[model samples]
Target: MDELIKYAKENRRLLHQVPEVGFTEYITTYLIYERLSQTNFNLYVGDDALDIDRQVGLPSDDVMANTYQRALDYGVPCSFLEKLHPYKTGVVATIDTNQKGPHVVLRFDIDALPIKESNEIEHVPFKEGFQSKHDGEMHACGHDAHAAIGISVATYIDEHIDELTGKYTIIFQNSEEGVRGAASYAKKGWLDDADYFLSGHVGTISEEVGTVGATATNFLASTKFNVELFGQSSHAGSNPQDGNNALLAASAIALSLNTIAPHREGATRLNVGILQAGQGRNIIPDYAKLECESRGETTQLNEYMFERAKEIIENGAKMYGCESKITVEGFAPSATCSKEMIDIVKSATVSNDAVKTIVDEVSMDASEDAAVFINIVQENNGKATYLIFPYHLKYGHHHPSFDVDEAVLEVAITTFINILNELK
Candidate 1:
């Protein structure tokens, strides 16, 4: 455990030095492969075998080509790599134990956000002078840690696979930040065979340097929407009344959307993230587009809120005499933790003297595509749970200065290894 912790600390510093965003994690993925190769784990990359163009979205095709070539260079083995749709990079690896028992699936998100790195002195890559070369893309959400932690767990499981009693699948998922990655895996039946599923996030909120925070029982289900409005364009001064204002309709929808929040019980959230309209202020906008998200603790409430949003958009457009279209970009289901699985994780953590805290809470405001896994498990009549390890940091998640106490990595590694041992 001590040696693994030391390894994680050293490796985490290196990973932080070079933050890569989303499916464009060419260098970061290579480094992970290089590190994990030394361990007993059977390394696999491009489990879906997606072509570079389909996996990563960049402004330049040349860059995507190069990244795809680099991933191919690693030559990780897998059964298939589908090149069907090329927007996300997804990988799946299977570790089968000859012995018969329940199969388990574990997932980790491997994408970074489109934010700049902080210039803080304690910020690793920045202090060491290895900040991102690609200006705006950074691992502001601690995904680099998630990747490392997943690798550490995979390595540990690999070394101990001979003594284990079941099969394990380690998934390296891409595009979690944008909420567009996991659906394909779920649809492809990647998790169909698993009897149990587990995943965790590293948060700065727990404050306990190396403790596992709340075993969250329920997380809000969320859906992303892109709305486009069409209206007649006319010169503002010359013919103001001749134009139907799409911008006006969009604004009305945004304002009226907030009215639905007070109607829901528990925590319901809504946000309008992106808005683009008009070329010039002097011209009545011909088209307006807005991207928004709505979330709720259950599917019923989520659907209800979504229906209200639809009404707002439809009615607002009619009132403004403009045409409107609403597109659901993506949807992630809510997560409800299984008591039995939570007990397993809690028992594992409590039994380990090194674990400082074990929290049990029902609500986590943030949404995870990992929830898709939990939903799959429950649907299959299996129990599942998700855990979080609190790593003390000065700033909140998705912030530029976001940094985690590296010591928590050890605690996570220990907890994962212990859980695997107990299951064995």
Candidate 2:
């Protein structure tokens, strides 16, 4: 147990230093493969795990090139990168016991938030030398801990296969930060044979040591998108009438999009987080990009909001005489877990010595891509549930100073092991 804790912490620390976002997780994939190479698990990646055509909001080719080179320079070999190149860095590892039993799938997201880490010495990550090495990328949301726990659980399941009689599957999912990656895996029919599905996030519901929360409900369905507006450019001081300003089009859309009325059926949230336009101050901007997201308590409500927002954007673009393209990069449907799945999590938590108490509380005020996986599994009549592991945080999620206590990794791994043990 001590060794496992040490292993989990070390893995978390190592992963923390090499933060990658979404589909460009080359270093993450290579490290996972290298560690699990000798294991008996049958791994699935490349075209087998994802459909790149369906992938949304993928980084540009130049970004991929820089990311690849960055990982290579960080010690991830080209051979490993080559294996994942076709798949765009998604991975799924499976181990079957051959005997007739249930098919279970465990998912863990492996992506970092796009935020630079705070360099203050008081921040634990900086104090410990585990600060993110990459600029504008950090595991501020604790996915690093999630990845370590996922790998540790996979290793344990493989080593103890003799004691289990089922197909144990672990998915090291990428691009989950924007809910971009999970749908591709789901679209590929990975959940067709699943009898049970399990996944979890590290915080938000659990804030103290020795506490665990099972079964989140009322998850917000969401859609992430980028809208690019195009117009003709001209000199600012001369013949300005010849130019159409895309920046005005995008700005008008942002202000109007926010004013879209909320639905009475459920909660709705919208934000335009990134809006970029213009080149030189003296030149009329020909192009502008707006990155935005919307969420609702139900899928229908989200669609309603998105459709209205789109109309506003379209008309706004036309009002400014600019062409627009709205691209839906990712989406997650709302989900509620079955009682059967909740009971399984409850039983596992009660039987584990590490978990002092199990809380049934759930906060669904936010969105998670795991909703995609859960919905797919449930659609096929498989029971699915999401858990929340409790821990202390030095700063709130997505903050530049965000850091989680290393001990929660223990709770995460043991809870997973106990659940597998119960199921087997």
TM-scores for the candidates = 0.88, 0.96
Clashing pairs in 1: 22-112, 48-81, 48-82, 49-81, 54-86, 54-87, 55-86
What lDDT tens digits, residue by residue, belong to model 2 across residues 1-424? 6666677889899999999988889998877776667689888777877767778888888888889889889988777787677437968888889977899999988999889999998998899898999999999998899888888888887778888988988888999888788878877777888999999988764378767777877889999999999998999898799999999889899999999998889899999999999999988899999999999999998898899989999999999899999999888888887678667878777867778777775776888888988888888898988988877765788999988888788888998888888888
**What would the per-residue lDDT of candidate 1 be over residues 202-307, giving only the tens digit for each residue?**
8846467656753675677888888999999999999999999999989988889888854436667788888889889899998899989988777666777788
Candidate 1: deviation at residue 260, Å?
Answer: 1.7
lDDT of 1: 0.73
Clashes of each: 7, 2
| Candidate 1: residue 336 lDDT (0-100) | 87
Winner by TM-score: 2
Model 1 scores a TM of 0.88
User: Each candidate's root-mean-square deviation in Å?
Assistant: 3.8, 1.6
Measured with C-alpha atoms, the lDDT of residue 424 in candidate 1 is 66
lDDT (C-alpha) at residue 237 in model 2: 98
* Segments in model 1 whose C-alpha atoms lie over 4 Å from true places: 34-85
